[model samples]
Target: MPRPRGHPRSLRARPELQRLEPKVLLTTFTLTSPTRGALLPAGVSPVGGIVIDLIGEGGSRVVSQIRARDLFVGDFEGGNPPESRGNPGTIGERPGFSPAVVDALGGALAELSVRLTVDDGDTGPGDFDRDDNTLLLNGIAVGRFDRVPTVETDASGTAILSENPEGGFRNDRVDTGFFHVTDPEVLRLVLDSIRDTGAIVVQLLDDDPGDNFFDFTVGIDAALIDVDLPPEPQNRSPRITSLRVEEPVVEGRPSRVIVSASDPDADDAITFRFALEGDGRIEPSETPGEAWLTVPRDGTVRLSVRVEDDRGAFDEAGRAVVVRNAAPSVTVAADQDAIEGREAILAIGSFDDPGLEDGWSVAVDWGDGSAVETFPVDRPGPIPPRPHRYLQDGDYSVTVRVSDGADASEASALVRVRNAPPALQQVLAPRRVTLGTPVDLAAAVSDPGILDPLTVSIDWGAGEPSRIDLPPGSTAFESAFLYDRIGSFVITVTVSDDRQESAVLGVPVTVEAPEPVPPAQAADQALAEALLPADPADPRPATLAIAPDGPGRPAPAPSPSPATLAAPIATLVGQDAPDPAPRASSPPPIPVEAPSAVVSAEQTAPAAPPPPTESAGVAAGSAEAPDAAAVGPEAIASASPSPAVVDPGPDPDPDATMAPETATVAPAVGAADAAEAASSTAVAAGDDDPGAETRSGAMRATVLIVAALTVRRGGSRIRQSLRSASVRSARS
Candidate 1:
């Protein structure tokens, strides 16, 4: 399509294009796709894939060729190749974005700005810069797989858009999420053009580049249909529409102040600036109509906003915001279901009194016996939610509490934790199996729900699938399989529980025709097989079963106290302990007193978790330990600078009897202090390695052991062992 050098409007009207009467033709004008930017008129570039005066309503061109100047809209000089592959190359197929504004723009609303954000199945409804290897709405290069309503660029830097997207990602049409288009030039065309012609003629194109049509696909989805457009436009001084202040603005907390203004000019772009005229503060955006206001103390503050258009004309508006020292507010969005052993998410929104700079603290009771997590915050922002993984399948009520020194707020969310899929612990399948000779296949699987029934389905990749049902609570199974076909096949095994959740394992196998075994070799193999250990009557593997300690369930006693743990220590390290005769007179289990959580004076807390199941192994409660993951090195290092705590009571007997397995152990004094100090050193030294987190847990156990051993060695040895344990913990 060639056009003369001087004309901006390459579209000329054909009277026949007018299907409606001259009086009422404008419904709404919108562009659903973006176009390539080649062969556009001289001074025009579809910067955001927009063109003027080209309209397509109901999928047909409203105007014919603009041949009034002796040149018609024609096909590109070269387009399709000899091998078409049956895909018709469009005429004059050029990467020329010819999205025409609805002729309603001649008198419609004047200004708009189109902003886009990436939805990578994570944080979005925000803003983003065009990343390199732009996968602009999946138009050109084939990119990585992203969820629908997402914008992702491939790692190889190609945004893939093919004619046939089978078994791959294809989201050609989508909701132009939260559209707010405000390009003044486009509005002017639509608003005034309709006034001039009484009918809006338009075309919306998302198409190919010139001569390159043979390779590239047709278009990319970019909807301007979502843009808000008014029917009429008038030239008048823009007035402030609204100035709102979000209420309950707490001191040291940030609150939202929304401002709006309207311009009736055909092509005016308004720029707004804001100022806090009182004790409050605000970081004004150059062209922002809304801002966050923060004040140091509780009081009233005045906010003034000024709006100036492209012209020198301007208008001013003011609003009052009340800041108070109120309890922090919290709102957590109900997130998707959490898989067992995976982090459960809580989407917490922020509520600022005015946008204060003070810090706060939060506490979370996981409703599991694991431990309560506490985080001390130092900034006046939304406190981060602690991460916790449930160990079993059940409902758990997670509670979140926040304190800002003087005031506190709490919330809760009901979380349903589904069973974790069975794990493929071990598999035994030969790479090459003799055809028709009984080939043995064995797979070991374990489920977190020890009582749940399990099944294993095997697909030999020979179009046959075989399933084996294991005994209830069984964790392993072995079977003999016979392959009749002689070819390479993938032995795929899928292990699923009643929950429909499953785990799969695949191994390659080649079944070959059997070869005759030598008589001596066959006898030797038979003797060897006869000597091999017979398959166990029960195939279940011996492994430690994880017990779920739900809320309200008191912890079972073990060592009792560090003062009398010498005997129990031997049993813990694998030495057997003498079994005691059953006694109904056993003392009640000691209360499991957990650590304390400290809250700061300036924080806002997020939402809480769900309630707990009745038969939990460990009750979820606030058990705050300032680990390096939540808090940083400085915080961890200073967490517990106090010396190792030793009870001043008379020393207990060194040969004190150990408590029964059901007996509870009291927490050791200064153990948290030692663990925190050790963590800080590890973090500062950057000892990040594979399984560092897992090792940290073991280190804590070792700390408790050392603390137990020190009780019998007297006070002097206590300090020495504490230092030794702290030093050794860094490498853990």
Candidate 2:
């Protein structure tokens, strides 16, 4: 039975008093986690019972008779099954404590006693019928509670949980409040004797000594009571035992902060609220006392936090730290109008930085196959212009990288490398030349890059340019002159490279006027043409004339000597032929284009020519034929091999004389055929463009060659005729 609750009127007799004012509690004795056999024949449910004894102030014991509350079966694993009934530590039973309330022998409630009980070893319903198995017997224990969440000794403390606890409609344990104590100091005294008793246990035995069953460990428990006691020591707020913010929190970088806090109340749950006094963020990590804090920019920041307990108590702590320097920010723009082969300069457009003294460097990649250029900057100010030289033309992406000691940023700008036009060097031709004189034209060209192939068109202030000899890997090209008319001429040279980059240059040259041609010379020129060649259908022979060897030598007059007229007398072996027909000539210059002037027939002369009767004339066809006293020079030149059919080979020595055999041509029908070929060539060329002296001069040369060939053949024929006549006479 529970006694009424009351506090003593006075402690004046406290020293002599054996116990405090009376108190009562609904006592509970439960058998839980009963393992072994429950002292039965096999592993089965046990009929449990409890015996409660309240020992008051002076160790005086009061035996309380309470039949086992749950006298039913339990499962094989030492727990009561849901359908069966047993004691698995469910509280709330008959109120039966403090019978003598306080023992008279002691001033305070001294001790309490509990014993577990189970039915006898008999199975089934007869188990608990025998009263002899009412109480826990000897020293051997049956089983134990494997795990316990927590245990406490506070005055109003509640047990977290013990093994084998249960709940019902009005559950005894409410959220970890399984066991409660009104006055822990009094309870401590009550349990003092058993606490040090070293693994105290409760067990029961059957008649068979060999099979010891129903052995269990009965635990000491706290009880709910009504008592008037001093207020519990106030719970203390959680403390920041060691608040540490890792140093060197760089801008935009994560830094670690650890908090060490504790609550004075052992059961208090601690939590932390982190905040920052700067432009930063605090994120709680998975770990309880750790967090990550990041500041966006460089500056001093304060990390403040509050450690709180479940109770309304808290402690605040804060720390100030300077964030490390951030990478300096700078805006970059580039010069788009960059010229090739010249320095392309980059200008720094704008800059924004937090650290004025941060050491920084800027690297520029010109992207023009050049090396990267880097410049060190002491601080945020006017950065020196970075420059690179691009030798080739192109569009480039200029990459600019700006880096402080710790961080770097990159920007790109598109820069176009304007193509550099070809450079025209000095023209190597003479400033002055005689009229009708073949001029050599040349000028140097450079493309401002590696030696690249070039296209060149050189105009000697005259006619169309048919060919230009610009060798591979050469910087300059040459063109021989063919000025139709002489004057103060301006030679134009156009140059270009594969990149379509072009340049033009003009060079002035004065052509001195020529002495006039006499009427006689004109007559000679006309005669040279008529005597030049015969149409293949009908052929004829013409007269020969010799030119003055030098200005001091008198000119030789033209005359139809027997040797000259004998050209028609020459005979062939197989049939009667007037003259060896001249080889066919190139198709008449088809006027493919109406150019300003005619193309000069490519020409070569190893040396000056000799008279027709000389051994040299008997051999090679030389272009320097005294053109019928200087009129056939053009004709003879035309008679020489056309450049179209010949590989002009290597240039020959101008001062070296070619052997007559060296220039020997095929069988000739006098110089007449050569002259005819030249004449036709000249007529066609002049029809296209008359007064083209370059063509006329070449025609004159070809004529002389024809006339010389005719004479040579005539002489051979004359000898053969004489030999035939003499042989006939001897045979007669």
Candidate 3:
């Protein structure tokens, strides 16, 4: 035989005689002894060819009948058996084969089929004619014209082999119809048949059950599917419930904006971020619920409030707020003119705002250095005027400042004050008067704005003045100046109010010396004197006296006889002498001489009693006769008689009778004689002469006559006698 293409050379060289020899190829065998079985030998090559060899006496010469149905050929090893271990080929047995060989043969056939398929060609009864006897080399049928061989079992249980000189196995003879009988019953029958055809003996060892094979031609189809997802949660918008501003809309100040929302799933509260319409900067607020933003002095600002939820959803709300540029207005006025040292009240007016409840105030500056006062208007009412007093005196600018809630305004006034001159009034009376005379001075003035008049004083240019009430309509006054000294003096009078004084007014007064002492008797002088004393030598008399001379007798003969004369002239000069003499002698007894020639009756009549003399004598008649009888010639001669022939002086009657001359003479003589006798006796006793006595007596008679004549000439000798007796008694 030639090797095929790409075959090895070791499989190509063999002798023709070896190829033609009948090699007792055990194609089929049956066992009559012990049991039916099959043999699997090495180096057998076929798809499905069963080879048998006889052995063991109990494995009798059993006539094994091989049927075509009992033999299989192909690559039996490629077929899986029904059991988990492996699939064994079936071998049919004749009835004469023992049960043991039947079982052994069945296993041997399966083994030989597996070995033959791996090594030789398939040789079985079914692979050739059934009635013909055949011989084979190995399991291949011998032929010259390509004829298949057939085999038969003799009674001795020998296999008769025959070859057919005909075309048999094809060149491409593949047993494509090889089927593995996994049915246990069918597989047992095939084993029985192999046991009976026991030319080759088989021993029943452990079965190699085949792996369980499943034809999983059916599959499941899988794909990834997608369904639509729920729509994403939408962002919720924030709500603005209320908006409020904390402060009044001052143009440039920061204000607060508050926003609210109703997001249950909110992670952050709403915040308001603000921006002015014209500004460039954006300010962020820190407050979560409310935000305060500074407003600019411009247009309205846009406020955006944003709130964010936990699901990363955000929402925003917006609003606009306006900012104004103008501030509040203020005006001020005063209730009175601005005067120095006087109160001025100020009234304030201002704009109103509800946000700023405590509104405006007023301050008054009185142009003096003083503190300012402030007022607050928290409610609706009139603002009390602020009063200020300026201490200085001059033109002053009084400033009043009124304030709004935010700012202030000012106004001023000019206050003029003229200096108040002191009020002056002069008080005086009798503008002119004699010096040293009293005059009244008074004044009437009024300071209506100052204290009372008692507080004022007067200065009369003299000293402090005494207070006085002013008379009606009198402004100037006069007071006494006893200007005893002669000169001119200016009287200056001034009136004073406490704050100021009046100008001095000079009143010139010329004081003259008083008129010389007026005559004392003058009307005015009398008055003056009444007030003074009287003069000493006022030679004026108050009374006067007169005297007359004696009566008759031709002034009584300037010269009389010395006897007739009275006493000596010295005696006549004496303060004691009686002015008139007394008649001491009795009346003459003589009658008046008759007209006829008769002797004078006086010569013839008796004489009166005589005045007693120092000598004792009684004159009786006639001036010469001491007594008629005694009338001697000598006595008569001795007596100084008057010259005779005398007429009777102033006798109213001449016829008066004459007394008897004789009787008158007798008594006188007797008286003389007695005196003589007594004297004689005294002489005898040593007495002086009686005749001398008589003559002495006669002288005594004449002395008596003279004394009587003196008495008669003088008046009243009785007064002289009484004056003499009173002197004698006083002396005694």
Candidate 4:
């Protein structure tokens, strides 16, 4: 008989007698490497397209393929002849047999014989012992088999027997060869290993090439192998601590950005890259650990700082620092006591950043056409305020500019510069007064908003000096001066209030002279003569020196003697004296004389004859009367001479008698003396010796004396008469 294909055959002997019908059953088996089992009967195939279903009754199935080298029967521990594929004559002498296969089969039987005794089977003539036992070969019954046992068949008759006398046997065994390998621990281990390497395993499922079975293979091609790379340390968020900018950061200045992070895992050493956000530029820094960025001039910029670690972790921070092209502000103020045209101190206001490493400077423009002053402030300290003076009058604008290293600020002050002199308002007292008269000088000074105690000075124009004092309204400057000079004089008054001075004003003063006199020539002369004296004989002369005898004594009267009368009369004569010869002779008298008594030497004897014409002849009984008659009958006949010499003298013409008594002096004087002597003697021999009679006689003597003296005077005869009459009347 030919060995059945795809199945194992056993060699055994069987009895010739009945040919038992074959029974067939399909069973599933899981085949795997290191197979250990008895070969299947001839002409049978394992179930489900498997060469062998190596599975427990209710356990998981497993399958594996053996490598070509490990598939040889000699690799097994048991000595069993390899199964034949061609016709075979005996169980051991079949074609295509290997001796290792036969020995493996024998060894398997010997092991089984040790465990159990063999069983007899039917045999025929020419039958050979073959291992073809159909025992209940539970895989669990057999504890373990090193190698599968092969079976041998005889070709002469259909009988199977035990070839090596170790019959087929049953034993308790676990089918460990069919390893139910669902080890979750092993899968976990594999996955952990992959993870440690930073890799991931991908499983690929495919149909097995030799069967319709699903198989799994690890796809290392798709596996992600994570090498021991440092994890990208969690990206640290950056923080901006502060922002600073210079006075003015131009294009040349390198702006800075500082970055910080809170990542403990990050190394302090970092790589920095700076970018100015929003239209900004950056220049690579030449210095180590420095990031430089530039802000474009066209627009403002916000800077961003990016810091990266060696592990490719990065942090970003941003801040804004302004960049400007304009200067800053500086203010200026003046002290309260500042004065115009004098030194004034000013307070320059605060600056933004006065302290700078580079020196700072200040420039001032004091509004006037003056030179600008520049001061340097290199450090932080109190700057001593400076003094400034303005001369012109008006409001002024003061500007101050402070410069830092790169920026500056300016401030302006409307310094009201009042260089104008104050206005002078004058107050005056008694605006009008008399000329050449004294008056009180008063003046008041008024300046708007000025304090009291204003200095004042007055030019009174009266040769008085100026006075200075504080005025109470219109204060009076009392000074007495006579304005004798007559003209308009300007009284210049000037005032000053220290802070300002005023102009001088001139007030005009008028002076005039007193009034003039009237004319009355005659009356003036008469009054002058009356006030003076006429002659020395007249008690007082034209100019008198009347010496009072005592306290109450009256002035003495000069006696009326010839010399006394002649002296004053000579003065008048000298003033009005005619030819001397004409005045020397007696003047003719009037014929209206009373009859005169003849007082001859015999007058006592002659009460004798009352001779009228005869006595007249006696009175003129001389050649003088005849001569007076011979010269002119009228002169001789009207001759009225003195009783003593009228007849002897030249006859006074009647026309001469008509002349003033000042022309008839001799006749008048002789007659007046005779009369006076007669009265004196008569009074001496008064009848009763009466005082009244004495007084009458004295009065008559005075009258006669005055008449006689007056008749000898010149000028007018009427005037002499009136004067004599006035004297007589006054005495009476």
Candidate 5:
């Protein structure tokens, strides 16, 4: 192991002797040969040991060296001098050392300071005493167990035994201490020896061997050295090049932040961390450098990411992410025409960005002072139908609102309600009726839906007014009025529903006067037929031209008076016989009232008949009385009718002369007698003829009054008075 002759100075100089870099060593040593009761035959002992030199060109070197020890004890029971132990033996053996020489060196020897640990199970002494063991490394005493402290148990609960009165049993008592090689001379001497020997030595021996024999063994589980390898480049803080949110940062929406960083030292591992300033959820993503976060509900959210290396150096980056809410948009529509009592449907539609689709609700206001209703919406689309009813008739504004917890939008529409009026179906009434008759008025009315009570009114035009109320389901109304006067009239009907809607209709009515009758027995019969009474059940009131103590004002009845019959008979004859067919000739002359004067001759009469003689009238009147010459002509006719009236005038005297006197006397007599007979007949008719007489008298008075109104056709001087003549007499 000596240096080679004339080698390079670097190579020749021993590492232990030169000013060199510090090195580390690890040695594992063990002793197992001394069985439980082995005796102290203290010549030499073989201990298996190895040296791990941790310094070489590649920074690692292992040299296994078997070791031996020699114990030359005088008394042998502990208390050996430190100089006598002289470091038991070299830790790693030289290639040529023998057993005695190995022990002679006192332990493994090397030219270096050392720090070491020893766990000893050597039960060298049987009991506690002044004698104890001493430990050495490189011939420098390091530690001692002088008091022989009580054995402590290991992790398995077994007693850590030392040299005791009984024996060493299952002990791993640890004694830790360090030794420094500070003396240059001693270090040189040891280095010279290592140049020759190539080993380091450590030892344990009895301090007072005469009293405590060295009969125990020890094992070392670990012996290590500390050295400074080139210090790794100081760990550099990780660099954060970029940091950002991966998706659009919509408020309340989930997204992620991505960070990019690097560690300067290749041996350093890195990790990422994230944080936010405002409301949000942040977590690590699948990727190491990315973090997941929920977007905050604010103007801007601060996001920060930190990259840390294994050496605890970290770098951080911050970002301000703009946070926005997706404002919802909605539209509202409703049925245009809504009835006051009917239900209406409102259609609402809405939409939003996908991110805000959840946690949203819809609200509707019916604008009629009703509560607003809210409905949760799971998806963005049309909202469910909203139904509402309006009690009042007017225009109402409807609104729909859509909100996504954070934002809202609204739309409005107009819902108008209409009021319908009542309808008038018809007005039933008679157009014409006689005075004093009652007119019935009726009407039919209706409204759109089931209506409230209806009010019906009629203006009967003649000052009679009537009103009636019909219940909800009824549509008919009736009224009655009597016409007091003879004239045209109008009736107006009005129908109204509870809502104050109304309609009106008009009807016309007319009333007329009755016809009059003339006075006579025959006329009385005619009047009876014409004025027959009406049926009782008739809705119409009885009518009469002449009112007498009735519901209406009474009017005067007409009086009966005589009417002539001669003119009517003469007119009948004139119509039945034509002038050419039959002519009464001069052979017969007709008497005015001969009971039935009949014409006998069929010969044509001459155009001019000679005037009558005065003596002709005397003879005609004297037939009934002698001395007729003494009576005036008027007296003679008043006395008695000529036989022509009592007895039929003979064949109207075919021999009768055309005497001017005859015509005068005969007509005068007949007139007087006819007047008397008419007067008598009128008296006989009595009460029956009173109404007819009244009517006839009214007619007569009307005609005379009409005649008086006429101006005379001739000169005023020729005017004559109209005498009060009997109606019969006037006609004759």
Candidate 6:
């Protein structure tokens, strides 16, 4: 059998060609000729045949052809005469046939066929012609034809070749059926033979010998062949067009999954299936290609959906979903006390599912008719505190809410707002502090609400108060100051919370001055007191006139002789010194002088007492002596009582009381002597002469006055004796 003409040679490498399955290559040919007016044998106007050539890349060739004599068989100028032209019979209808020679070589052959034609001129040589053809395979006779067209003859009895008066051949179209080796084993041998030998040949031949004598003109209009190639299996796995699942899968909660699939082969039937390998359960839904699922507690859920075609072609798609717990729990806290115009802090906390605690967001409400605030939380534990300030005093509440977009929770707390003025709890200070002394002062200051920052200060009377700032929530404060001046001072302590409110407290302190000392005197105090009597009738009158050197009094005039000097009359024995001196016979006694200035009365009682001195004899008469006995009755009657002398009390033993003046000279004699001097001196002068008597009394009083001054200068013992003597004298 002939191979198909114009088969494409293999363009692949040897290894690629081996990979290709063996199959017959099909081709078709339309035959035509450019040689039109060639000389022909008698009774044969024109004849033609067609041959096809196939060339391979490896320098191989294959050929196939259509025979001309197989169609239009006739004999005219030769021995046989032509029969009627119009009637022809069919060829390929019979069933019985002998196998060709090439059928033994696996009988893989390409087929060939031809159509015969005849035409007349314009005068009409042949007007009607039927298409009749013979088919050939590998040069073997395969088909016989009988249909043909006939031409009318003119009076000359000649067949027309053209209908045109100008003379031209007929033009028409015809078809040849396809033929080729289709058996797998036969096609494989054929392809192998061609590949090995590098070539194969096909030819066409006229099977009727008598028809060949007419040299019938044959034309191959077309040739076609079938190949051993069937369509590719066309079995394609189904493709997963789309896969989807409901988002945010939660533990122990049902989720939905949707899957879609398609196959390239439209006629293929497909079935869908689903699987969940871990952390979840999956089941097919009532609808096709859909499923329902529940995830396990925490972790990933792996899901796979598969689609299978009727031809066993299949495809699958997989997905992973992470499951989490429920909504988060939130809590908020803040300081209970809040002060107006002060800042307060509120803290937040949240707890989420065990493995899913990371991402979150928070919103807060200050509960004071203000907008809510929101922020994202990057950390999982306690959140940083948020700060807020209140402008007015009132009670306020706070809230904090947390969310993970899908779930949320919240917590709340309360904050108390108050305009608590600064308070001074206690001032630790001293009452009596000395000038120039640094006193430690401390004040316990506090705010009952808000615990806002406070300032504590102390005004230390002398200057501006020193101040110290306290941080929020502080209580006690202290400082020190030195008072520069001394007096009653008021200390003020002021405490402020820096929030337009403050408090103050005050304290008192006192100071004093020193005392002065008195000067000492040298006069005798006891004698002087006796001279200046309290009673009007007493000797005070005489004493004031006669006693020249009494307390706060001036000294008497000095005389030439000591005995006549009244100023020295205090030198009298047994009396304070300054007693009158006695007169002498021959020589005048040395003059006695008086002190320059009057002594202070307080100096009479000196700090220390003087030693006792022996008694000195008083003058009985002197140049200036006067006689008290001669005084007139009027002078005597008018005389006040002598100074009340401090009398020494008589001793229980008479002898002691009568003891000599020398024995009592220490203190007792002074008192007694002062008393008697007034009278004794008077008596010793004249008792009959009134003028002399008055003069004597006056002199005596002067001596007593000086003696009293000396007694006062002595100690407490001497003073007691004076008192005793004064009492006795008064009694006497």
Q: Write the per-residue lDDT of candidate 6 for residues 186-261, one digit (tens) a residue.
A: 4455444544443332222323222322222322222211111111112444667778888777766677888888
Better model by TM-score: candidate 1 vs candidate 6: 6
Q: Specify the poorest-scoring 10-residue window by lDDT in model 2.
A: 9-18
Over 564-667, each residue of candidate 2 has an lDDT whose tens digit, in order, gives 22121111211111223344222221111111111111212112222121111111222222233322111111122122211112323221111111111112
Instruction: Give the per-residue lDDT of model 5 (tens digit) for 1-732.
Output: 122232111110001111112423221111111111011111111121322121111111112232212222233322243344332422222243234433333343322222222334344244343245554544545334442222322211122322232323113353222222234455455534543554445555554444433322133211212111211112344567778786567765677777778865567899998888977769897889987787645467788877777856566668788887866778666546677656777566555544434468888887878799888888777777767766556788878888888778898888887766677898889988877778987777776534457788888876758889888767777788987888888788888777788898889888887655533434422322232211122122111112111122332222222222111101101011112213321112222221111110111111122222223321111011122122121100111111221121222321222111111011122222322232322233234544434333322222211111111111121011111111111122
> Which regions of candidate 4 deviate over 4 angstroms?
1-192, 195-199, 203-255, 259-272, 279-284, 292-302, 306-454, 461-494, 499-512, 517-732
What's the lDDT for residue 654 in model 6?
18
How accurate locally, in lDDT, is each candidate? 0.39, 0.41, 0.31, 0.33, 0.41, 0.41
- Runs of candidate 6 exceeding 4 Å displacement: 1-256, 261-273, 283-287, 292-301, 306-426, 433-454, 459-490, 500-505, 513-732
lDDT of 4 by residue, 1-732 (tens): 122142212111112321123522221221111211222222221111112212111111111121111111221122223341111100111011133322222221211110111112111112231222211111112211222231222221122222222222212111111211122343334323323343221111111111111111111111211111111112222222333344355533456543443332334455667777665566656653355555534236676665555544344556666654434445456523345546677665544451223566888787877898889876534445778876544576777787764667777777665544444555454555566577555554454323324566777776775667654233323334467666666677777655546657767766665543323323322232232212332321111111121223332232222211111111111111223342234223222211112121111211221111212211101111111111110000011211111121132222121221111112212222323333433343354434435433333332232222222242344233322222222221
lDDT of 5: 0.41
- Which one is best on TM-score? 5
Model 1: per-residue lDDT, tens digit, 1-732? 122232122121111111132332321112211111112222221112222222221111121111111111222234333221221222111122222424323324433212122112112232121121112211212122221133222211123212121111223211111122234454455434444454332221213323212111122223311222222211233457788878878787777778788655547788877888778678654446877878877778888877666754345777677777767666544643666756666544343333343667777776766687887777545656556677667787776776676677877777777788788888898888778875678888988766567888998787568889876578788876677779888888889887878989988888898765533323322332232211223222211111112223332222211121111011111011123224312222222111111111111221111222222121111112112122111101011111222111221212212211111112222223334433432242235444444433333333333332322122333332233222221111
Q: Which ten residues in a row have the lowest lDDT in candidate 3?
A: 542-551
Tens-digit per-residue lDDT, 1-732, candidate 3: 211132111111111111113553333222111111122122221112322322221222112222222333232234322221213232212233445544433242221111111111223334332222222222222222122322222222223323322322222122111111223343344444444453232111112322211110111001101111111112232334555555454455566666655543344443344434544234556666676666544456665655544533334456666654434333444333443344655443333322233455666675656676666665433446565655434575667665554555566656553333334555444455555654455444543323223233333344345444333223443344344555555665555433443444556555556656532232322332232122122211111000001111121111111111111011110112223223233333322111101111113211222222222212232222122221111100011111121222222111111111111011111122222322332233224333433333332232222222222223233223212211221121
In terms of lDDT, model 3 sits at: 0.31
TM-score, cand. 5: 0.34
Tell me the lDDT of model 3 at 100: 59
Candidate 4: deviation at residue 176, Å?
44
Q: How do the candidates rank by TM-score, highest first?
A: 5, 2, 6, 4, 3, 1
